[model samples]
Target: MKSKSIGLSPKSFYYGYDSKKDLKHLVRLVLILVFIALLTGMIGIWVVYRSAHERHLDMLRAFANTQGDVLDAYMLLDEVKSGRVHGDTPHEHNLDNVKELLLKQESFLETGQLLLAYEDTSTGKYILIGTGHMPSGQHSVLVVENTRELTPSMRLALEGKEGVLEGQDLHGAPVVTAYLPISKHNAGLVVMLNQSEFYAPYHRARLITLGIGVVFVVFGTWVIWSAEQKNLRQVREREQLIRLSFENSAIGKALVAPDGSWLRANKSLVNILGYTEDELLRMDFQSITYPEDLEADLDHVQAMLKGEINVYHMDKRYFHKSGDIIWSHLSVSLVRDEQGEPKFFISQIQDITERKRVEFENQRLHERLMDQLSLRRQQLDTASGALEGFAYSVSHDLRAPLRAMSGFSQALQEEYGDKLDDTASDYIRRIHRASTNMAELIDSILRLSRTSFGELNVVSLDITAMSKRVVENCRVVEPDYPVEVRVAPGLKGQGDLRLIGSVLDNLIGNAWKYTHGVENPLIEVGQEHVTLSEQSDDSVLAFYVRDNGVGFDMAYSNKLFRPFQRIHSDREFEGSGVGLASAQTIINRHGGQIWAQGQTGKGATFYFTLNHTQFDSEKNSTS
Candidate 1:
C-alpha cells in the first residue's frame, strides 16, 4: 500500500514557521514599550511634583521677606519718635499706641498672622508684645503678659538670623513661619501661614498631572500595540503638547545646546528679546548678551557643565533686537543624560527693567534730598554764627556803658549827698537801679546764646555728687534762707558734665529761691527708671528735682521756658526769667527733654532725661 499522504507543501511549512517567529517578536516589542511608558510616566510625575514643591516654597519665602520688611519699617519709625517731646511718662505708652496702629494696619491680611515678640532676658522665654491676629478663643488684646516657651524660629530670630521655619503654631496647626529681628529694640517679628493653605495650589496641580499622565500612558500602550505607525504619530503628538506647554508659559523659557546656541526658544523668550523664534534659534546666547554680562554668564555655564553647581541665577542685561539694552533676571539649570553627562541647558528669564528703573529714580531722589539737607544745614550754620556774633557784641559793648553809668550815679550819690536836694538824690538812685537791672538782662542774654552754641563733652556723671555741689553753692549765695535738701545716692547719668551741672544748678536754685518763707522747706533730687518707646527694656533714667515751693498756675506752664517770660514779678521772685530758658537749651543740645509740673502754692517738680542713654552718637550728632 502507498504511504498515506506522506507528501507536504514547502510553502505551507515555511509560512507556519514565519508566523511563530513574528508572533514572538511582536510580544517582545509590546513588553518593551509598556516598560518604557511606565518608567517615563513615573519620572514625569516626580519631576512635576518636585517643581511644584519648589515653586510653593519660593512663594512662601518671598511673602515672608515682604512681611519682615514692613515690620522693620514700623520699628524704625518707632525709634525715630522715641525721644521726641511727647510730655508723657514712661515712653512705653507711646510704643503701645504704635503697636496698636501696626496691628490695625496689618490685620487686613486675613491669610497670615504678624507678631512682634521679645525674649525676656531674665526668664529666657519669648513674650508676644503685639499681634495682628489673636489665637482662637483669645480675647485679650495685650499678649505681652502671656509668655511662651521659645520656638526654633523665635530662637533663630533672637540670635539675629532671619529665616523661615516649618512647624506647628501655638494652636498646634502645621504652619510655615518667617522671623526677623527688630535690630533697634531687641525684638523679633514673626510671620506665619497655615502650611496646608500655602500648598493647596500644588495639591490641585499634582492631582491633575496624575490623571493626565495615567490617560496618556494607557493611550500610548494601546497605540503601540495596535500599530507601529500609529505609535510614531502618538509620540509626535506628545512632543507637540510639550512644545505648546513650553511656549505658553508665563515666563520666558529656552532650550540651549551645549555649544551655547539656542536650540529652541518659546514665544515669551522671543518677545522678551524682540526677535522671532527662528531668528533666536539661529543665534547663540553670547551674541545677545550685553558685553559686560557675557563673561559672568559664560563662567556660570562652565561651572554648571563641570557639575560644580546645579543651577545659577543672576540679574543681567541683554541686547534687544533693536539694539536697546534690556534688564532681566536669569535662572539657568543644566540638564543631564542618563549617563550623567551634560546634555543641554534650560533657562528661565523674567523682565526686571521696570524695577531697575524705579530703583534708579529712587536713588536720584535720595541724592537730591541729601543735597537739599546739606544746603539747609549750611544756611542754619551761617544764621547761627551771625546771631552769636551779635550776642557777643551786645554783651561786651553794652555792659561797659551800663557799668560806667551805674558807677557815676553811685559816686554822685556819695559825694553830693549834702549839696543835692532830696529829689536829685532819688533820681540818681533810680539811675543806678536801672543800669544794674539792664546789666543783669544783658548777662542773661549772653548765657542763653552760649547754651545754644556750646560744644558738648559726653561722659558718665555722678548726678548725686553734682547736685550736692549745686546745693552747697546755693547755700553760700543765700546763707540766711532756711532750706533742707535731700539728694538720692548713686544717682547716675550720661551727658555733658558741664552742661548737666549747669542744669542742676538752675533747677535746684530755682527750687531754693521759690520756697522763700514756707515752713519746713524741702528740695529732693532723684532718678526714676522709665521705659522708652524705642527700647524694650526700662533702663532710661528720668532725673527730677522736687520742691515744696511757690508753684505757678498750670495755664502759663507753656511760657515757663521762653526767654524773658516770667510768671512772677521781680518783687515776688528775683529773676531775669532766663534761667529756665537756658536750661531748656542745654537739655535740647543734649537730645534730652525738660518739663515742669506744679500748682498754685502747692509745689513744683522739674523732670528731665539725658537721652544719650536711649540714642546713639549718630542720632545725637544730628540733634
Candidate 2:
C-alpha cells in the first residue's frame, strides 16, 4: 500500500521552482542578438570604407610626389642635353641622368610602369618617346606611347617652362606627364615622366581589407544582441507582475512628473475621472479644476511646500473625456528627491461625485426651509404689530369710561343707597370691579404697543452705564425696595439707544418685580468677552443681567419670546408677560441674540449677544 501523505510529500514536490522553456523566445532572442551583431557590423563597414578611401588617396599623393620628382630629374636631363646643366653631356647625357633617378625611386613603384613624354610644339601633340626602370614592390612597371595622341607635352629637351598632360598611354595604363621647358641657344627642350601606375596594387589591397572588416563586424554585432535578449526576457517577466498589481489596487493611482507630465496612470484613476489614462495625462490639474476650486488647490499646494501639510486631501473636479465633470476626493503625497526637494506627486483618488450630488441637494432643501420659516416669521411680526396697535387704541380709549363707571357707581352708592337694596349695591360694586380689571388689561396692552412702535436713538452706548441708569430709575420708582446692581465698566456696543434702554428697562424691571417678597433683591450686571472658537479666530462680547427673581422652567425656553406665553399665572404675578418678549424683539432688531437661563424661584440670568464680529476680526489680528 502507498503511504498516505500527511502534507506535501517529498516524492511529489520538487525542492524549488524551475523555469518553463519558451522555444519561440529562444529563437527570438537569437534573432535580436544577430541583429545587434549586424548593427556593429555596419559600424565596422563604415570604418573600413573610410580607411580604404584614405589609403587609396595616400597612394595617389605618393604617386603624384614621385611623378613631380621624376619630372624634375628629366628636366635636369634636358638641361644637360642642351649643355645648360653642369654635367659631362654627350657621353653622360640627359637620358642617362633620368634613368638613374627613376631607379632610386623604384622601391615605391610596386609593379607599375613609368614612361616619359614631352610636347612637340610643332605638332601640338604629346609623344611618349622614352622608358625607365624602377625597383620592385606590390606593382610592376612598363612604358608605353599613346595611340590617341593629342597635346604637346612630349618634346625631348624642354626643361625650363611648365607644361602639364594627363591621359592613358597606348597600353591603357593611366599616366600623368609633366614637362619643364628648356631654352638654350634658341632651342626648346622638356623632360616628362609617368607616375599613377605605381598606386594600383595598394588600391586593390585596401578593397580586400574592407571586405574582411565587413564580415567580422557583422559577426560581433550578433553576439551583443544575444546578451540583450537575456535582459529583455527578465524585463518581460517583471512586467507581468507589475500588471497584476496595478489592475487590482483599490485606490486610483497616478504618477505625475514635476512639470505636470504624466508618467503613468492606473485604471482606477481613469474610472474616477471618467477619462482614459491617455486623456487625463494629456492635461494638467489647472485644466480640469473648477475656477472656484483652483485657489484652494493652490493654497494647499503652497502649504505643502512650506511644510504645513505632509499629505493633502481635497475634493476637486476633473472634466471627463466625455465632457462631463467628475468629482474626486484625492489624497496626494509629495515624493521628494534625496536633497528634500519635491520631485513629483503621487495621487490616490476616490470618486465622490455621488456624495457631492446628495450634499448639494440637501443644501438646497435646507435653504428652502429657511426661506419658508422667514416668511412665516415676517407674517407673525406684521400681525403682532397690528395687535399692539389695536391694544394701544383700546387702552387709551377705554380708560375714561372705566373711571366714569367707577365714579358713577360710587355716586349711586352715596346718593341712592336707601332706594337700592344691599344686593343691588353689591351688583354695582361687582360691575365696578370688573371694569377696573378691564382698565388694567387695556393699560398692559398699551405698554406692549409702546414697545412695538418705540423710537430708537441709535448710538454707541456703554451697557455698563445704561444698566446702572436702569437700576437707579428702578430705585426711584420704589424708594424702599431693596435692589443690588453690579455693572462692569467699559461694556460698549453699537445699537439703538432707546431700544437698548428698553431692553434694560424691561429686564431690570422684571428683576425688580419678580424679586418682590424677597428679603433683598439681588441684581448683578456684568460683561465678559468669550471666544466662540478654540483658536479665538472669532470672539463675541456678551452682557448678562442676573436677578434673584421668579424664573421659569427650562423646558419652555423656546416659548419665552411669544407674547403672553408666561409660565407664571397673572393672578400670581400681575404682568402682561410681554416684557421679556419685547426685550427679545428689540435685541433681535439690533441683530443680536437674547437668551434666558433660570430655575423656578432660584433666579434668572438674562444674557444678550451683540455681534461685534468686526471688532473681533480687528482684535484677533492685533493679538
Candidate number achieving the greatest lDDT relative to the actual structure: 1
Q: Tell me, by TM-score, which candidate is best.
A: 1
Off by over 4 Å in 2: 1-426, 449-458, 528-542, 548-574, 588-604, 610-623
- What are the lDDT figures for the candidates, one per model? 0.76, 0.64
Q: Which stretches of candidate 1 lie over 4 Å from their true place?
A: 1-245, 303-308, 338-341, 407-420, 529-541, 612-623
RMSD of each: 51.8, 17.7
* Model 1 TM: 0.58
Model 2 scores what on Cα lDDT?
A: 0.64
Error of 1 at 469 (Å): 2.2
Question: Model 1 over residues 1-623: C-alpha lDDT tens digits?
Answer: 11112221212221223445555786788777767876887788779778876776666667656766665566456656765444434234434554666556544244466666665555555456434345632222333333445456766776777877888776677877777776545666667777787667767876887688678767876676578546445755665667678879878998776667776677888889998877886678889999999999999999998999999999999999999888999999987766886666889988888898898899999999999989888988888899899999999999999989999988888888889999999999899999999999999999899888857998999999999999999888888778899999998777898888989989998999888878889999997654455556534457899999998889999999999999999998899989999999989888888888899898898888877645454335544
Position 302, candidate 1: lDDT: 91
lDDT of 2 by residue, 167-261 (tens): 44444555554444334221222222344453354466557755775566556546645665575667656665565566556778776554445
Question: What TM-score do all the candidates reach, one by one?
Answer: 0.58, 0.41
